[model samples]
Target: MSETVVSVRDVNIYQGSNLVLQDVNFNINRGEFVYLVGKTGTGKSSLLKTLYGELPLREGTANVAGFDLKGMNWKKVPFLRRNLGVVFQDFQLLTDRNVHQNLRFVLKATGWTDEKLIEEKINDVLDKVGLKSKGFKMPFEMSGGEQQRVDIARALLNSPKLILADEPTGNLDPETSDEIMQLLFQICKDYGTAIVMATHDFIVINRYPSRMLKTERNRVLDSAVPA
Candidate 1:
């Protein structure tokens, strides 16, 4: 069995007087692909924020990447993010920087020095996302899919244990979305990197079946598997 990478116990989150989620209990095992689906305002983003330590847990308990979400330290936010690979619908890449420079920036900021070693690691991760030739291209020069691949490459620089994606394919065409989905799945299968993606794309969910978790009627529904 894969290791349980994320564990939540009756987690509740709120924004002002609004209770976004109630009693959200679930487990995400290593190498598992999970889909978080719901209406536009059903706490998807909030959950991702909590996982990455952007928001504090107001009630219950949560653990992600071995850090306590309820009592997470301020200084450890960077450390938590380093263990998590985060992707967004909008490809967040520096337009002025080449793919190599972008990846290098993350390495240098994350405390990776040693020019020779940094270059080697950058090359290795670029290759991992099937973008070895893209190292010299600018973000705008690359195709949308390729740009997202570069984003994935940046996320993988730290060899994160889990990938938390927020609407990862929300801006892509159907074909491009399929390609991105396949890429994410392949990475999880090959590297045992568990993934929890929040998206409204039910078409992709229908095309590629995964363990589904949805927020409905003030509760989290794990409906993909028979209980």
Candidate 2:
């Protein structure tokens, strides 16, 4: 059976009072790798925000990682986030912390109380991202690719069902981007985690094609749909 990680139906996304995307509908299944592509100001960010519960979904029936987006509130947002991971273009690691402490901080904030379990989880993610030995290094001491790996490792700490990656390879060189892309695809396959990556890199898309969801003309276009 195919499991849905994100489902948006009859949605109208907005930024403040401005309608950003209209009639958006899509379903992303578990272990699927989907690319979200759009030009600047084409409502891609709005759609991502809605999926992650950062922006209120006032005009749609959508579910992300089994949480009803329409019913999301400030109190429920944290719980919803626990089931999802978000990766950014910029490796948003704290400058003062090493990789281990950075990962530990996220686990603690998300309510992991057992020290032994936390240590194990951190180790697990670092190993997955090919950074097992670099956990003691500070973010500034690492290369762009390594920092991005730590960011990915941090995202995996909660074992989320869906990962929302915003331009995850935007900051790296072509070679480094390839490495990150491979790691992302590996994670999706190995863990059965769904990924929705928003990117403007057409070169990356051509190199590693998959299902694509494009935001254009105030609407979302799915490549799965026939013209």
Report how far residue 177 has shifted in candidate 1, in Å.
1.4
Worst-scoring 10-residue span by lDDT in model 2:
150-159
- Listed per model in order, the count of residue pairs whose N, CA or C atoms clash below 3 Å is 0, 0
Model 2 CA lDDT for position 208:
97
lDDT of 2 at 69: 91
lDDT of 2 at 61: 98
lDDT of 2 by residue, 104-186 (tens): 99999999999999999999999999999998999999999999999999888899999999999999999999999999999
Assess candidate 2 and give its TM-score to the true structure: 0.99
Score each candidate by Cα lDDT: 0.89, 0.95
How high is the lDDT of residue 25 in model 2?
88
**Per-residue accuracy of model 1 over 1-227 as CA lDDT, tens digit each:** 76889999988988777888898899999999999998877788888888998887889998898888888878988988889989978889988889999999999988897999999999998998889887999898888888888888888999998999888888888998999899999999999999999989989999998998997777788975466
lDDT of candidate 1 at residue 211, scale 0 to 100: 92
